[model samples]
Target: MNQTIALIGNPNCGKTTLFNSLTGTYQKVGNWTGVTTEKKIGQYRKDKKIEIIDLPGIYSLSATSLDQKSALEFLTKTPPSVIINLLDGTNLERNLSLTIELCALNIPMIIAVNFSDKLEERGVKIDLNGISKIFGVQAVCISAIKTKNLDELIDLAKTTTQKPFKISLTAEKGENSAVKRFSFIERNLDKIIIKKGTTAQNKTQIADNLLMHKTLGLPIFFVIMTLVYFISIKLGGVFGGVIKNLFDDAGERLSIYLSEKEVYPFIQSLVCDAIIGALGGILSFLPQILILFAFMACIEESGYASRIAFLFDRFFRAFGLGGKSLLPMIVSSGCTATGIMSTRIIEGEKERKMTIFLSPFIPCGAKTAVFSFFATSIFGGNALIASSMYFLGVLCVGIFGRILKNLKVFKNNKDEFLLEIPDLHLPNLNDVYMVIKEKIKEFITRAGLIVFCVSVFLWLLKSVGLSGYVADRVEDSFLYVLGEVLKYAFYPLGFCNWQTAIAVISGSFAKEAVVESLCLLTNDVGALFSSSYSAYAFMAFILLSPPCVASLATAKTELVSNKWFFGMLAFQTLTAYTVAFIINMIGNIFVWCGGLLLSLIIVIIIAISLIVAVKILSKSKCCACTNACGERKCKNKEKHSTI
Candidate 1:
């Protein structure tokens, strides 16, 4: 028989750590809350045959945020057979509030106080019997990080029995009551927790004073970001080239072997060009993704992410977003699917939807590979060109966010923002390595499945045409015919070539496919463009457009409406086209006149067009979900409805 055990805790309380320790599952663990935005299930690798479901962290079961809703549903509707309530021993006073609330659930639970190792260093001790007596639950002091007492805690959970109990310790026990529950927890803490006198100044606080300093905070953040990008882009690029050479050599050998074996020409071309060429190009960038994830995991585990949120609270509010929006944008730099899921922590529906809308502009890891390729190939490894694209993305966010905020189409911009800052510590190397490993595994699996399938499909499109099943030349194929129709749409952006047009269209499926498609098309990406300016325009369009298909599915789920999802995609695509057109036109004028006069004239015309677009959008007051014929999805739907 399989047993089910649920791990519950407040955010940043080592719940995921304990789950990982118990099951050896490589679920994401960060020092900040909201890292695990959804429930995850893992079967124990040991002989116990127990299945563990790790629910999202929640302070209580009030069900305001999306994660809270999930937790509440799991506890009330589908309660686990046993729950392991994880807690942070260092912050017992605050962490115990949730513990006290859990006692009211009448489920069999074992309290496992994690971070015991850190508590030991602080000269703090938790009396297990005292805690057990107060909550009528078996309590164990264990450090998930240190792998101490985990087996014992699991054994207790295995045999623990559920019985009806009264939560009478708190006088104020009623629906939605929390004050008396907290007071009860405080009294218990006073009895059970023994702390050494006159504790020393905390390193976290000391670091925060300097790092979060009013004038120095932003600059310090920028410096750290620059270093992260430098290491991932430059250092990772060096290692990527080494891996690329190995894959290239293997592909050459395979191609030669196929030819020598007199394999079917179609099969040879399919395997060599489509499969090896496209898939190999994507796999070669694995080193960069892993290196980037390592640095990001380090930053997240250090507890500095919460501080960055605090630092940006005011700036985010000024643009009609709270600090919560920042986390999704940061996560998007890694993957947009996770980023969209991370928006669950945002309490405001409007902010959450807007966050989902804007996160794709942040340029995900796959896009970073595309940028790296462009930087090295088109711009001769000019780091500024790579970094400038990211900065342009940020600028687009601010500009677009402001436009959306002023439109009055979205409500709930003034929602409350609350964030808990965790104590800082050096990131655990084991945890960081595990995160990198998980990321690499995910990337490889995705590349193997999605990239492989897409590559085969593209190869077929490029290999066959109307006149012949297999074209003599790629330019005579159906893909080139299709791309010719699309290229005219991009003529304004200076990407008039059919090959570049197809590459851009392929990117909508997966951003990594952009470079891979280009590789399969021609060895030199630079030769396909008329000028460096046009190449930059192509890169800009890729950066500013809607993310890949997986992210779109996530957005659709989060938005809960197909109309809004399609609306957002259209909006983002238009924004990418407009931005790329402006950039291309400006670059042309600059090259033609070499001075400010002609550029100024072009800028004025572009500015007028932008202002006109914004004014029309803001004043129209029509439903965003309407079709081009000015008809809403349903006849009864109101005009100016919230998207």
Candidate 2:
């Protein structure tokens, strides 16, 4: 019989790791809480018939957090044939609390003690047989990362006898229930667990002391970001140049051969310019993409990412953002779709909506590539310029966050922040490899599917026009006409040229297509740029605009309102135009001045605007609080106000 086994465990117990080992699936696994916020299913690799359901990691079956609620709903609605309760062996006493809760479900379960290698290394012994006898279920020690005894654990789970159902599913919620669970765990651990010595601070704690130091934390983050950009942009560019040359040589030979064969001009243009020119330009950055994800994998594996989140929590809360928003913003840097989905952890609808609106401000990998490419092409390979785009994106988030927080809808909704920091360990090379491999595969799929379609459409638009589908002269085409119409909308931003305007419009389809469309339009980027200021403005508009169609669809589903969806869309477009126009004006006025003068002027303008906006917002918020509370308590209310 093919058994349907459900894998459940507390957060960061390596439950997802074991699931991947059994099913050979690539669901994102991280050493952080709430990474897998939803359920996933995959067939067991050894037997196609056996299905494995990987539920979200939950500390208890109580419907408190969203992941916990999801796990409870799934099990209650569709009980599995067997349950694999993964336990962290090093923290056996704490993990047993959840095991005790699961016992009340009246379902058959086998305890698989994961992270056994770490426990053994610490000279800790867990008497699996003794615990099995007490709990009346099969128990085994297995290392999910090392793939040790997993087969035996699976077999034992498949054949284990069910424990007697005693505890009530509708157990009373109080301190008494929690005490009973703890007492039961203590009794079981007394019989099975043996410790060599008293626990003390280890290397992880020592490292955390330095890494999480309040004064040094923010600077450390900046230094790390600088290094990542240097490696991905500077080092990757060196390798990308080689790939570009290879593609260019091949394209030139193909073009010469096609001309000798007297191939049709349309066919030549499609093959040489549309396919090779457009696609090759983006593909050359593949090395940089891989390197960027690799660094992300390293940060995630090292457990420093959770620390960064913790470090930023207080500051983010000051801007009316909860700690949960940090993960979505971080994930969005990789892809906005996943980031938007990650907002499920935020229970408040108001906070979730705000997170969704702000997530697009963080440039995803595709946008990062565009920024890197333009920074190189225009600024002669300035990694600082590429990195500045991300810094600017973050600043925009803070400014916008302050404004959004004071709004009436978001007032008085302050979600609590809680997280468990995982112990530091050397990241497994194989895990890092899997992450990079998955990212590369996604990039290629998007390029082949969405980007390819957009590229073809752009070629068609530029090739055919009003004079009965003229093929060669694109200036008279429909694209030219449409670009002319949109040009005026962006005229203030100095993005008036038809080609530059067309690229921005094409970007709405897919951000990467901006570079692809631009490649198809002009052989010389300098020709399209009247001045360097316009180039920066164009990049800013693309970076700050609303996300692609796929991302918008995800936002719409989460938002569940057409009115809010369109509102967000309009807001993003206006914000992009305003920011770009401001930068363009600043750049034009300071062009004759040196770079240092321009930087000083730009900084001064941004600082003044932010200061004025914050003051106006603060006064409005104070008035709203007084109206809500009362005039007599206005002063006291302002002192304790959350919004």
Candidate 3:
């Protein structure tokens, strides 16, 4: 008989790790909360008929955030055959509160105590038999990371039968349900848990002391991110070169083979130039993408990512976001759609929607490919230029966030930020491998499917004209006519050419297509731009513009209204254009006028103009009184005392 088991636990309690171990599927396990924003299903390795569901972590069934709501909805609506209440062995006291709540559901359960390896080191011990007897469920000590005793845990889960268990969560007068639940956990702790030795000084505290210092925290984070980019882009480029050469050689050999066979030139160009060139150009960046995600995985697994949220909380609040917003932005560096979905963890509807709207500004792996390509072709492979785009993205978020917050629609509601900081430990190589493997798979899949299809389609557009099949005269093609009309729109950004316009347009479909389209259109992408400043301007446009269609769809779903969706698109596009225009204008002044003083003066003027514009736009008449018009405070305060 097929059986489904649900793995539920508190945040950062190793539930996903156990899921990965059991199913042999890598599902983006992390050291922090909200990693699994939705339910993930995987069939057991030993019994494919039996399915394992990994639900988003929750503190209780009383759900507040969307992710928690999802978990609660699933458990109540589609009750699983057995529930594996995964507990963090190191923090059994707090974890048991959730277990107590789970017991009230009266479903068959197996208590799989995770982090068993660390329990002894932390001077904590669990009475497994006592826990089993008290809870009336099977209990086993299993290290999810180490995959220790997983078979026994699974065996117990499969064999366990439903038994009625009474949970006495009786609250005294004026006591709340939350207190009663914890009180029951406190009552049971003496019998089920044992403290063997005195606790040692926490290494996490020591590390946090230096890493999260009030003054040093932000700088440390910046330096660490800089290093991550340096290693990923600069160091990974060495390996990327090898992959690039392999593709180049393959394209050349395929071209020669097609030529020797006397194949039609159209077929030859389509196969060699469009298919091989475009797809290969994108796939060649796989090494850099993998390296980047590997570092990110390590950051997540090492538990430092949560610290970053805490460190940036105060700083982020000033811009109308809380610490939780940083996690989604960080995830955005990998994929904007996933990042947007990650915003479900935020409780406030306005904040979550605002985060979803702003997430695309942070460059995803696809946009990273575009930046890396430009940095190589135009900037002589200076990884700093590529890395600077990431920092620039963050700056855009901050600038736009402050602006958006002033608007009534996205006004800050002072959402409470509660993040659990997991214990710091060396990143598990297995988890890092899984992260890199999954990301690389995604990158390759896109290159093979979406990019490959887009490349062929673009080649057809470039090859065919009004007269038909004018492969040699690309300028006379339909694409040329289309680009000619569009190029004027981007002329002020300094890249007015048809090819660059086509690339920019294609990028809206998929960001990696920007690189793919350029490689297909021209032999030398550098020649498309007149100056490095123009190239950087184009990069900024791509970075800040509405993300690919997939991310836009996600934003639509999250925003839950067509009006907000289109507004986001218009807002992002305008932001991209304005930023690119400013960058290109400043660059032209510096280059053409050949005076740093004049450039600086222009920058100051632009900055002041922007400040004044923001002030004018954000200004609103007081709802309290008509006398408050054009005044900082309402003059007739006593007339509308409530307001």
Best by lDDT: 3
Off by over 4 Å in 1: 62-66, 162-165, 169-176, 196-198, 253-264, 467-472, 591-594, 598-643
Candidate 3 regions off by >4 Å? Answer: 162-164, 380-384, 524-526, 530-532, 588-597, 600-643
Comparison by TM-score, 1 against 2, better one: 2
Q: Model 3, 212-256: lDDT tens per residue?
A: 898898899999998987787776778878877888899999999
* TM-score per candidate: 0.88, 0.90, 0.90
Model 2 lDDT per residue over 100-217, tens place: 7888887899999998888878878778877777667888899999999988987777677676345443334664776777776766676878554347888898988888988997
Better of 2 and 3 by lDDT: 3
lDDT of 1 by residue, 1-643 (tens): 6788999998888888888888887877788877887788887667458888888888887646667777987888988888888888887787787876777788888888888788777778778877777777888889888889988988888889954245776365463466776777766676778654237788888999988999999999989988887888778788888878887888899999999999988888888888878766887788777888888889888988888888897677655677888888888888888889888768788888888888888988899899989998989988888888889888788778877777666744557777888898899899999988888888888898777777778889988887665744877899889988988999999989888888988898999988878877777889988889889999999998999998988899999888889889988999999999988987888788787867678688789869966764454322554432233244534433433
Q: Ten-residue segment with the worst summed lDDT in candidate 3?
A: 625-634
Q: What global local distance difference test value does model 3 have?
A: 0.85
> What lDDT does the true structure give each of the candidates?
0.82, 0.81, 0.85
Question: In what order do the candidates fall by TM-score, top score first?
Answer: 2, 3, 1
Ranking by lDDT: 3, 1, 2
Q: Alpha carbon lDDT of residue 275, candidate 3?
A: 76
Q: Which 10 consecutive residues of model 1 have the lowest summed lDDT?
A: 627-636
